[model samples]
Target: MINAKEAFLKASTELKENGIENSTYEVREIFKELLKLNPFDIDFAQKELSQSQEDLLNDAVNRRKMHEPLQYILKKWEFMSLDFNVRSGVLIPRQDTETLVECALEVVKQNNFTQCADLCTGSGCIGISLCHYSKGLFTQGYDISDAAIELATENAFLNSCDRFIAKKHDVLLSAIGKYDIIVSNPPYIKTQVISSLQSEVKDYEPHLALDGGESGYEFYKAIIPLWKNALNKGGYMCFECGEGQAEEIVKLFEVNGFSQIRTFKDYNKIDRVISAKLL
Candidate 1:
């Protein structure tokens, strides 16, 4: 007999008490999904909750209480103006990664690169967004994890980026072709730092996508040389980096023959992107 508003408030309060961040928004979204009601529609409805709906809401609340990621509970996430299916095995696309996409697009626009590669294409967010934003640019995305490749492929189709191809190939071991532009938001969080991350990330997200080796620059080290070999002269490479990691990544690129290196900051003024062109 509880009204929708009452249920939402109760759920929100419970979630907050359990240390879940964004409790109100999480509860509201759960209510919306269960009742097929929007936030505004919650108050107008007088219908009783169905048994299945009640069960779903309760399960979701419990999961949130455990500090599970909201995206995992919902089984989907949004990035770059598109919806993507996500599960525990795949790293959820984050807003900060969009900065990598924007920077890559700018490089492509400035240099008119017709082909690009998205290394470590988790969920296909970068490559798919590139194809969506860059007209006539052919994009190829590579991931070492099979699950990541499957999910990225699904995301590509979901975003209507059929021209974008997602492949399973380890950047560290594979021989890749030269590209005009290459962008990656690779795993940059140091291995030792993984356990200290929020539960939503360390517990729920895939470790394969979060651990960047002991120094958190394993992928950067492995890819820089490969990128140097794979990018045409004058082609560009961009990486989404963790704070304090941009300079080290830039040095890697520079030592491997990249030039005109530069880093771009996110809205918070933290350096989040590094860009350079092949010599």
Candidate 2:
């Protein structure tokens, strides 16, 4: 019944009233997703939404008003410029994580690495993107959450990266097999700090993917030592760290006797990714 422009204004107003920053962008994304209308382009002005389409848009807006992440509501998000499926149980892919992917790709290219193990591979973003970008690269993605595993596998197939395999495995355990490189964007939020994160993260995102234990280094502490055994001699380990966590993570790699340690920053210049090579 309502024209697309009116729907866009109404949704944007409602979302802005709910304190959602980037309300306009969110509204445009919702409109494009639910109504198949490009709110930014010329065609969006002449478009109209059917009754069911309007209902769907309203439902999406209501969900966003509750502080649910827009990515989860859309059930898909872009990472490394590739589409990935996401939902309630899996942690949504984020731009910061792309730094880890880039560093891993660099390592893979420089070292001619082909076998990779991706830990906490939510939505298969990092591993799949590696395989997507680097030909002949094969990745085995591991996660503890069944939902994460399912979505990761689905994302692998969606990206046409059949070389990426998703499996349910706790990273705290011993390594399964040796690989040319190991990469991860493991959960590193301090447990107490998690509760203080924005509602979109604390309420909607899975704690299993956010709670990094009391020190926020639980996964890193475990994976660095345990999974390093799974890496071939001279293999590499690349990881995405929390804002202030990379320095200490580098120390961990040092203590583990990893050589050629290096850190990379995200667009925000935060120390986001760290890499090291086994001697």
For each candidate in turn, give its C-alpha RMSD to the true structure in angstroms. 1.5, 0.9
Please report the candidate that would top lDDT against the real structure: 2
Q: How accurate is candidate 1 locally (lDDT)?
A: 0.85
What lDDT tens digits, residue by residue, belong to model 1 across residues 1-279?
A: 556666667789999999987898888778765556566763445656666766787899999999998888887877888888887888898898888898998898888888899898988888998889988899999989999899988888888887699999888886488799989888889999999998889888889888899999998998888667888888889999999998888889878888899999986889999999888
lDDT (10s digit) by residue, model 2, range 1-279: 888898899999999999998999998888777677787787877888899989889999999999999999898999999999889988989999989999999999998988999999988899999999999799999998999999998998898888999998888977998899999988899999988899999999999998889999999999999998999989999999898888899999999989999999999999999999998
Scored against the true structure, residue 52 in model 2 reaches a CA lDDT of 93
**Considering summed lDDT, which 10 consecutive residues are worst modelled in model 1?**
41-50
lDDT of 1 at 158: 82
> Considering only N, C-alpha and C atoms within 3 Å, which residue pairs clash in candidate 1?
none
Task: Give the best candidate by TM-score.
Answer: 2
